[model samples]
Target chain A: MNNKITQNLYLLPYALWIVLFVIAPLLLVLYYSFFDIEGHFSLMNYMNFFTPVYMKMAFSSFWYAFLITFISLIFAYPTAYLLTKTRHKQLWLLLIIVPSWINLLLKAYAFLGIFGTKGIANSFLEAIGVGSKQILFTDFSFIFVSVYIFIPFMILPIFNSLNEMNPSLLDAANDLGASKWTTFRRVIFPLTINGVKSGCQVVFIPALSLFMLTRLIAGNRVITLGTAIEQHFLVTRDWGMGSTIAVFLIIIMFLIMSVTGNRKRGV
Target chain B: MSKLVRFFFAIILVSAVLFYTVHELNNSEGYSGRNTLTIYNWGDYIDPQLIKRFEKETGVKVIYETFDSNEAMLTKIEQGGTTYDIAIPSEYMIDKMRKERLLIPLDHSKLPNLHYIDKRFMDLPFDEDNKYSVPYFWGTVGIVYNSKMLGGKKITSWNDLWDSDLRNKILLIDGAREVMGMGLNSLGYSLNDTNHNHLHQAKRKLDLLTPNIKAIVGDESRLLLENEEASIGLVWSGVASEIMSENKNLEYAVPKEGSNLWFDNMVIPKTAKNIKAAHKFINFMLDPKIAAKNAEYVNYSTPNKHALSYMPKGTVNDERFYPSPELTRKLEVYENLGKKNLAYYNELFLEFKMHRK
Candidate 1:
């Protein structure tokens, strides 16, 4: 009991931090969502959010998030699989994670230089007699950079899951005459479902709120809920409206997590 | 052994926290009982040396703070945790604040150098009588184009943006108000026209230009232009002048059609605790030599008529910085559209931004 009490004491600081920063700020956002700028009690903020324009924005935000999550998964799973199968697995994994050491904003800015009209992408295209094509401010560059920035989040979790896979189970399947692809499909893939689901949650939730990247990389062609909330609070000074949008985003994130996180936990 | 080191770190951390807490509490009590004037302005808008000079001239200690945008400044002032003696907000914001009675009127006696203000900058729509504001810096919205790429062709009118030859080479300012104002001006309409149909028409014209536009940029426009990635960019006169100074191949022109003539004005808020010092500071900034120094430092034009004579010989003659008379006659300053009109513009322009096709 004394040891348990000491361990609990160790957790006290982190618990206090969570309550102060995370829970308190979220509670504040929830409270402000119900009030207008003048401190009047009103549902107009929420009512305004129910419009078709915002509905379309919410749809696009989720679709983009889903697309980015899906793309990151495709790239990550293969890289992770290769990492697990590699001779020097730790070194290869470290190499894959090297890009994450730099900030996302820096990475996005670097991509801007690489894909600019006078940049490497266009220069190479021209060299091949294809002539220059517009790359910056396009949907392609935005999606490309987002995938680049977020692949690590997806990879690290998947790698953890893959690394922990019981090799005996895989060997048993192999001894039973199951081919490599078949064993991966039936045995390895099923056991790693937890990681895949959790990794998707990690990427998808933040992807919905990528406000700055959409502006920097996409050049305003892509407007997510994150950007909408920014426009309301930063540009329009409509904090109530911003909080309302933020509350909706929080709810959507929860809904996505519950659906992904709670299923088949025994695995 | 590690536990002893950790305990030592804990003690040091606690001491640091206590030190800062005591230090901040001391600062809040005022510095040695000296008179302090707090001025809030856009980041890097004023020269630091001028603030020191003002502090030296007057026995007043100056505390300066900065915000990145007008909206942020308004929000900060309204929330009222901190009081600022003076703030330099743009002209349209002055109009909004005047409506809110957030500003206190200036006493002409306290600001005798007000006479040096150019006649053109005086008696404008935002503050016609200069009741609550004093002009600080002014610039015009204009085009900065690569002259080498243009083959010496003069790109004067806003219509040149729609020219097919410049397709995928033109950069528009990412701001909705700036871009929409140009669209309205190109159509020979008022830049401040809040009429619904007129706004939609401007949006329509803006939508058409999307095909030719390479990128809509904020600060990155400078990098893009410098790299020759973008041939022409719609930019502020001050930025254009800076660009021209860097690259001789670039030239700036005020479109034949009108564009925004922006102003940053110094105003004393109603909550100001140092009104007298604020007035003195404003007056000092209006002084010929001081104003010229400020103008040269910030690379923006001075509203003081006498300041021009004190500046570099060709500073006033630089047509890029100061538009020609014909173009100046057509330039329009943005007016503060009230909450309703502002909301409408944001919504419409947001739609335009999202549907960039």
Candidate 2:
């Protein structure tokens, strides 16, 4: 009984934090979603969300988020795999994480300069005989910047799962006359599937709500659900519609988690 | 280990509680005995020296805060934690705030310097009879183009933006009202047009200009144009002035089709803790010399008629920033379009934005 009391005491702060920050704000958003612009309680915002315009925006936002996550995975998996083989693996991991430690806005500004028409990317293209092109504000620039920002997040989890794997399993596969590719595909991948799922979860949710990158890098060409929410809340002062979108985003997040969530341990 | 963890949690919880208590105590006691005025305005919109002058002149401690947008300022005031003495909002927002009862009706007796304001800027559509708002700075939205890059073609009208030669060379301002206003102006419709058919027609017209548009940007539109990244930009007259100062190749033009005439005004929120100080500050800012200093420093047009004499001859006479009366007649100010109509404008603008190739 005494041990249980101590454990509960230790858990109190975290519980309080979750209640105050996470649960309260979520409840507020849900409450706000039921109202219209005039503060009258109505289902108008929810009804509006189902319209073709918002539906198309939601679909496009999903497509962009999916593309960003997929690209981040493709780049991160190899980088993390190679880093694990390096002698100074932790140092390499530290280097990868160092960029993430910098402010997101600063890194975005750096990309704005680098991908600009007269920037290094275009200058290099010119030197290579491709000539300068409109690199900034394009879909390519947006995806590239997003993938660059999210790669470290994707790699860290996969790196940890790879590190935690038993070396004996790999040796056993080799001893059993299984090729390296077969070992990786059949054994290594399944064990680290949890890591991949978690990594994707970390990247995908934030990617869905990306508002700043859409403006700064994409140059307002792309409109995510987050951008729409920001527009409604700040620009339009239609907090009800913004809240309705938030509620929907939360629902979608839960649906995504269940689909990609860890299953029963053995089965 | 468990004991250590419990100890840490206890420390965190206690510290959080103590922090909250101290913060509350400081807030309550800080203003009770002090002569402080909290003024909320746009970032870098005023001269810091003028603030000091006001403080010294009135012997009131000035607490200055800045917001990037009128909506953000409104949100803060609506949330109602800290009481602000004064706030500056644009014309359309002033109308919205007046309707919401967020503004305090000005006592004309307190603001004796109101007579210094230009008659041209007075009794406008947004706030007729100048009930709550006093004009601070006013400007128009126009095209800022690089002369050398335009291939000897002069940009005189909004129709020039649609030229196929300008394809992928234009950067538009990232604002719903401003961008939508551009569309409406090009279609010979009022910028504040709430007609469903007219707005839709504007959207269709804007859709055709997408191929020429490089991107929609905010403050960075100036930087892009300065570096010659894009040849032309649809920007505010003030931003265009700043850009022109930086890059001599750039020139601003008020399109023949006409565009938005926006004004930023000073007003007191209804929740003002120091109304006397707010009025004093407003009167101080309206003084012709102070107004001219602010105008020159911020590169925006002064709405104070007497301030024009105090300003540089070249800048005051610049037609791009200060359009002639004939051109001014063509321009229209954005009206408060109420709640539902404003949201519709934002929605239509969003649809136009998402229609990218």
Candidate 3:
């Protein structure tokens, strides 16, 4: 009882801060979502969220985020496997982490310098007597930058899972006359599924909301739910609409988290 | 622990808290009193020397913060946390703020130097009789092109953006209102039209032009000019001026159809704690010499008639800076659309973005 009391006392400040900052603000957003700017309670803002344009923007955001997650996993898995196989793991880890320490905005800007119309890629192509200019501000740049920015998130978790794998299981599969590829597929891949799932979750959530990169690098040619929320709050000054969209986003995130959590519990 | 040491620790803790609280209180009070004023404005939109002169003349310290967009400034004020004594918002946004009752009416008598302003800029639709806003700078949205890259072909209309010859070699402003308004204006409709069918037609035109566009850039027309990324672009006059200054090959021209004329104005918000200081600062900036110095420093056109005389002889005569009366007559100022129309316009903007291949 005394220990519990001490623990509660220790958590008091954190609980108060969270309630004041996070929970209170979210509750205010929820309240605003139900009303218009007139202060009277109304459902116009929520009704507006169901418009076809908002639906399209939300779907596009999800689709792009899904694609970025899947692509990052595909590229990350092999790299993580290689890192585990390397003898000098610390040096390889350093190489990966060092670039991540560079600011995300700087990295996005770096890609701009390399992929712009007169950038290195185009100059190289020009030197080879090929095409003189290149396409840089299309959907392709959006996906490329998102995948590059989020590869580290995918790799770290998969790397941890791979590193934790017991060699004995693979040796056992080999002893049982299974082929190397089959053993790896059956034993190794199944064990790392949790890590892959977690990594994908991390990558998806951020990519869904990380529209600033899209705006700056993709030149605001693409619109996402994140951009819509920003425009509603900042540009339109419609906090009611902005809050409604934010609430909808939170609901979608909650659904994703609960479904994933239930699957993990069942496993 | 010894009683003496415990007492010392308590004193230290109490003093630290007191110091922090005092610092915050001081910051709040300093801006509220006659000692200082706070101004929020658009980035690179004003002359820093003007701020310095205001500070020196009035003995009121100025704390200035810059935002890149009018929407951003409005959102900050709407949150009702920070106390900004003065702000500069575009004409349309000023209308929106006035409807929201977010602005405090100007005391023109307090601003005696208002005589320096051209009468045409005053009593405009956004704030008639200049009740709330003071016009700071005015310019137009138009097409800027490289003569060398265009193969000596004279570009005249918005249709030039859709030309097949410039495929994958054109640029447009990233702003939805600006780009969509251009399409609407080219279609012989008002730039601020919120009609659904008109918007759809504008979207169709933009969709057709998207393939030819290399970038939809904001505040980076110089990058496009230096890199030769696009042969032509829909850009602001301020950006066009900067590009022309750097590269002599560039030329700015208003479209034959028509274009947007915008004016950013200074206003005091109702939430301001230092109204007197804000008014004094506005009057100080209105001084013709100060206005001229500001206009020369920041490359934007000033509304002060007296300031125009003080500008460099070439700048005063420059056609781009001061368009001919005929050209000026063709321009239209953007007006605030009603709520329903704003929704429709935003919806159409979304459709254009999503339906693009």
Candidate 4:
């Protein structure tokens, strides 16, 4: 009981901070979602959320996030596997992690240098007589930047999971006459599923709310729920509507996580 | 553990917490001294040298803050959190702030350099008699195009954005007000129109144009022009000038339908602590030499007649910088739409954004 009291005291600061900053703000968002500027309680904000335009935007945001998660999973799994098997594992990990230190906006800006009309890609294509002009500021650029920014998130988790896997289990499977493919399917895949899910959670949530990169790379051609929320709060000065959209986003995220969690638990 | 090691660890942790506490306390106090003045303005909107000059002249330390949009600035100010002495807001926003009792009216006697302003821009709708705000810079919203890509066609009006040939080849401002205002102006409606039918019609036209938009952009016209990511875009004159400076192929022109003529003004908010220092700083910036130098650096048109006289003859004569009086007559100033109208406009903008097509 004394040790338990000491541990609670140690946890107090962090618990308070979480409650104050995260939970309090989330509750405020929920409350504001139901109230208008005049402090009248109404469902107008939520009903407005159901509009076809916002519905489309919400769908697109989820769809793009899912696509990015799937792509990152495909790319990161092999990369993590290769790094684990490599001799210079630390050096390879350092290389992958290095770009993560750079500001996300700077990374998006750098994409402009490589993909802009006068950028290297276009110049090279023009020189080789392959293509005519730039590829920057399109939907492709948006996806490309999103994938690049999020790949690190995907890789680190999977890498840690792979590193934690017991080599003895693989050896035992081999001894049982399990082929390489069969062993990977039965042992490796099942074991790494949690890491993959957590990685998706990390990448999907952030990618869904990515406003700056979308604004920069997509040239605002693609509008997401995140951008709409920003516009409402910052530009329109309609906090009621902005908070409503944010609440909707949180609910959708909750639903997605719960469903995914249940599926992972096989319940 | 050794007593010495435990003592060292406790010292390190205590000192770290102490340092963080001091930092937070300092930040919370903000500009406290009588010698300090905080100015909040748009990003990259002013010449840094002008602020330095003001500080040097008045012996007041100037802390500069920036926001990308008027609404963002208003939101920050409305929270009653940040104590800013001077803020630069657009004309309509100035009116809004005045209505909200957020602004402190200026004493013209304190601002001796107010005489430098041209007679034409005075007594404007937003702040008639120049009570609450002083005009800093003025410009028109217009289209910037690459002449090389338009097939030698002069992209004269907002209608050019909808030309079938330009499909998937144009860009527009990401700002709802600017774009929707342009659409309204193109349809012979007021830029500040709040009529639901007018807004819907403008939105429908924008719907047709959305698919053609290569990207919507704000404030990155320099990159867009240099990279050729867009052939034409709706941009402010200051940005247009920057684009033209970087790329010779780039050109800016006001649409034949007339475009938004906006003026960013300097004002003192009610929460200002150092009103005297703020007034002195404003007068310092209004000095003709200082104003002209700022205009030259920022590439925006100054509202000061004396500043114009001090500028190079060619710059003053440049049509892009100083449009013909006839062209000036065609430009319409945006007015602050009342609350109900603002809500209606916001709804339309939100609906359009939600609708993918």
Candidate 5:
């Protein structure tokens, strides 16, 4: 009984933090979602969420998020795989992560300069005879910058999973007369599926809610669920609608986590 | 099933406690000492030296903060979390604050330099009789174009933006009121037009201009124009003035179809803890020499009539930066469209943006 009481006391600060910061804010958001702009309690905001305009925005936002995650995974998987083979693997992995330690806004601003009309990218294109093209404020720049920003997050998990894998499995596959590609496809990939899932989870969810990149890089040509929520809360002072959208986002977050989450019994 | 029921009950109890605690926290008044004054204004709107001067003159520590947009400022002020003594919001937002009773009326006796304010800028519709707001800086929304890049294509009117030759050559300022006003002005309607059919028509009109529009950007619109990324831009007169100084080939024009004339005004919010110091700061800013210096620094048209004498000959006389009185008369000030109509405007603008894809 004394030991049980001591354990409960140890959990006090953490429990209080969860209650005050996490649960409280979430509850407040849920509470705010039921009201209209006039402070009147109503279902109007929820009704508004179902409209075609918002629906289309949500669809496009998901489409962009999917594109960003897929591109990041494609680039990250090979990079992570190669990192495991390098002699100084940890040092190279650390180098890959160093860029991410810089502020996201700073990186976005750097891309703005690099992809500008008179920027290095255009200058190179011109020198190579492709000529300069409108690169900044395009869908390509938006996706490229997003993938660049998220690549580290995607690679770290996959790298860890690859590192944790038994080297004996590869040797065993070789002894069984399997080609390198077959070993990777049949053994390595199936084993590292958890890492890919977690990597995708880390990238896809945040990509869905990316607001600043949409503004700075995409030049407001693209709008995401995050942008819409910011617009409603800050721009329009319609917190009710913002909260409603946020509530839906929370639900979608839970759904995504469950789908990609670790199973009870795992390899 | 019993566990699930218990879990839900615990959630309900926790939420009830949270709501009560939050309510209590909001009601608890923050302690505001006499020597401190907080001022919130738009980013890069004021001269930093002036803030230092104000602090030295008053012996009061100024806690300064900045916001990017009027809506953002309003949302922060309305939350009542911070006790901001002074804020500078544009005309329509002043009107909105007036309705919400978020602002406190000024005591004219405290502001002796009010006489230096331009008669033309006084008693404006947004805050008639200057009850709650003092005019800070005013400008018009117009086109900023590089004549060299345009290749002899003079941009005298909004219709020029729609020219097929100008395809993918224009960058629009990213604001619902400004861009939507462009569409409404092109169609010969009031920018504050609340008619659903009219707004939809404006959106459709903007749709045709999409081919010429390269991007809709905020502050970067000026940079894009400076770099000659786009030949023309829909931007504020102040930004146009600043860019024109950098590149001599650039020129600003208030479109022939008319445009938005915005006045940013300084006011004390209802939550002010240092009203006296706020008034002193306002009076100091209104001084002709100070106003003129601020005008030159920020590159916006000053509302202090007497300050013009203190300003440089070329800057004061430039009709593009300071629109002629006759031209200023034709420009319309944005009115507070109330909460519902303003949200609709934002929605319509979003739809227009989504259509760009």
Candidate 6:
């Protein structure tokens, strides 16, 4: 009882911070979503969210985020699979995660240097006489940088689930004369659905709201939903509209979580 | 099974806490007690020595803070946490604050050095008769080009940006108003053109330049030029000044066709606790030596005619910093286009960004 009480006391500041920072701000956004600029209750903000331009923006943001999530999964899966099979697996996992410790903005700026016209990539291209390429501010650079940034999120959970798989069960499937591909598909893959769900849940939501990448590396060319919210809040000074967009973003994120938050727990 | 579910929750909760805490820490507010002159200005906008001198000379505490954008400054003032005595806002924002009564009328007697303000920089639309704001820095939107790539052709007009030879070599300013204003000026319309049809025409003109364009960017425009990623960029005079200082081959010009002339001005907010100290601070800034020091430190043009001679050795007669009257005749100032039109302009810019083929 005494130990439990001390632990609760230790978490008190964090709990208070969450209430003050997280819960209060979320409630404020929800409140703002239903109002206009004049402090009157209205659905105009929500109504405006469905306008043609906004609808198009929402679709594009989702498409780009989906692309990012899908691409990160493709790259991260094999790496995570390899990690589970490695001798020094812990060290390899540490290496994979260590780069993520660097600041996102710093990494993006460094990439800008690497991707600029006089950058190493372009310099190499010119050295080979393929000619310099306009790679910076292109969609390829934006997605490539995003995939680099978000890959760890896709890898960790999948690693956990793969590492947790019952070796005896795999051996049993092999002993039952199931072919390698078939056993892996019908047995290992289905069992690891929980990990995949958990990983997707981690990666998908933030991919929707990633702003700095869209701005810095993409040259403000890609208008993600997060960028739109920033414009409304800071540039346009429309708190109501920004909040409405944020609310919709939360709804989309929640939907993503639900779809990926596996209900069948006994995987 | 439950452990995985709990693990996912813990991951999200930790990230949420991290993001919220970092954001909060970055924007943590500061307060001033009494007899303090609190001034809010742009980041790295004014020299530290000036703030120290002001404090030392006046026997008053100085609580200085900085914001990066005009909109951010406006948001903080509207939210009303810190009691900022004096704020340096851009002309359009100065106008908005005056209209919104966020600023108080200045007492000219307290500001005796107001006479040192160049007649050319005064009596502007943003603060008519110098009621609310005193010009801090004035500059124009212009082209900064790498002469090495121009091949003996003197690029002197906005049309130069549309040249097919400069394909994917032109970098435009990132802001909605700046980009749309460039489009409007290129079409022989006013930079502050409000007509719906004129805006559409500007958009069409921009679409043609899109093929020749490198990217729409801000802050990094100078780096882009230095890196040779872009041969020419439509950027602010202040940034252009910084660029020329870095790379000798780069040159800046206020296109003959004209461009937006912008000014940052200082004003006393209505929430001022020490209005007298605020006036003293503004007057101190107008002191020729102090104004020169500020201009030298910030690398932006000063509007103090008296301070021109005192400008740091190389900056005074720099044509990029001081345009002739003939050039001034071709320039226009950006006016607050109202909430609806500003939104419309932003939408247009975003649409253009989205449809990048």
TM-score of chain A of each: 0.92, 0.96, 0.92, 0.92, 0.97, 0.89
* Model 1 stretches with alpha carbons more than 4 Å out: A1-52, A85-98, A126-131, A264-267, B1-40, B47-66, B81-86, B104-115, B123-125, B128-131, B268-284, B324-327
**lDDT tens readout by residue for model 2, A6-119:** 999999999999999999999999999999999999999999999988998899899999999999999888888898899999999999999999999999999889998889
Candidate 6 lDDT over B8-87, as tens digits, reads: 99999999999988657434522223477889988778989998788778877788898867888998898898799999
Clashing pairs in 5: none
On lDDT, the stronger of 2 and 4 is: 2
lDDT of 2: 0.91
Candidate 4 interface RMSD to the true structure: 2.3
Better TM-score candidate (2, 6):
2
Candidate 5 local lDDT, B1-357, one digit each (tens): 999999999999999999988656434533223577899998788998998888767777778999988999988888888989999999999998999899999999999999999999999888989999999999999999999988866888888788899888888877889989999999999888999999999999998988888888878788889888778999989999998999988988999898999999999998899899999999999999999989988999999999999988999998888887898888999998888988998988888888763
Candidate numbers sorted by TM-score from highest down: 5, 4, 2, 3, 6, 1
What lDDT is obtained when candidate 6 is compared to the true structure?
Answer: 0.86
Candidate 4, residues B1-357, lDDT tens digits: the string is 699999999999999999988667545654234578889989988899887777666667788899988889988999987979999999999999999999999989999999998887787888989999888999999988998877677788888778888876776776778878987988888888888898999988877776667776767766776557778878898888877888888888898888898899999998788899989988988999989999998888999899988898987887876886677888888888865577677666656654443
The TM-score values for the models, in the order shown, are: 0.85, 0.91, 0.87, 0.92, 0.92, 0.86
Per-candidate total of colliding backbone pairs: 0, 0, 0, 2, 0, 0
Q: Is candidate 2 or candidate 5 better by DockQ?
A: 2
Model 2: which residue pairs collide? none
DockQ of each: 0.44, 0.74, 0.46, 0.51, 0.51, 0.47
The residue-by-residue lDDT of candidate 6 on A1-267, one tens digit each, is 999999999999999999999999999999988877666799998888898778888987888888988998888888888999999999999999998999998999999999987889999999999998889988899999998998998899889888999889989999999999999899988988888877777777888888878878887778888988888888877778889999999888878777667686566
> For residues B239-324, what per-residue lDDT tens digits would candidate 3 score against the true structure?
78877787887888888899999999999997798899999988988999889988887787888999999989888788887786
- Candidate 3 achieves a global lDDT of 0.82
Task: Give fnat (model 3).
Answer: 0.53
The fnat scores of all predictions, in order, read 0.45, 0.84, 0.53, 0.63, 0.67, 0.59
Best by DockQ: 2
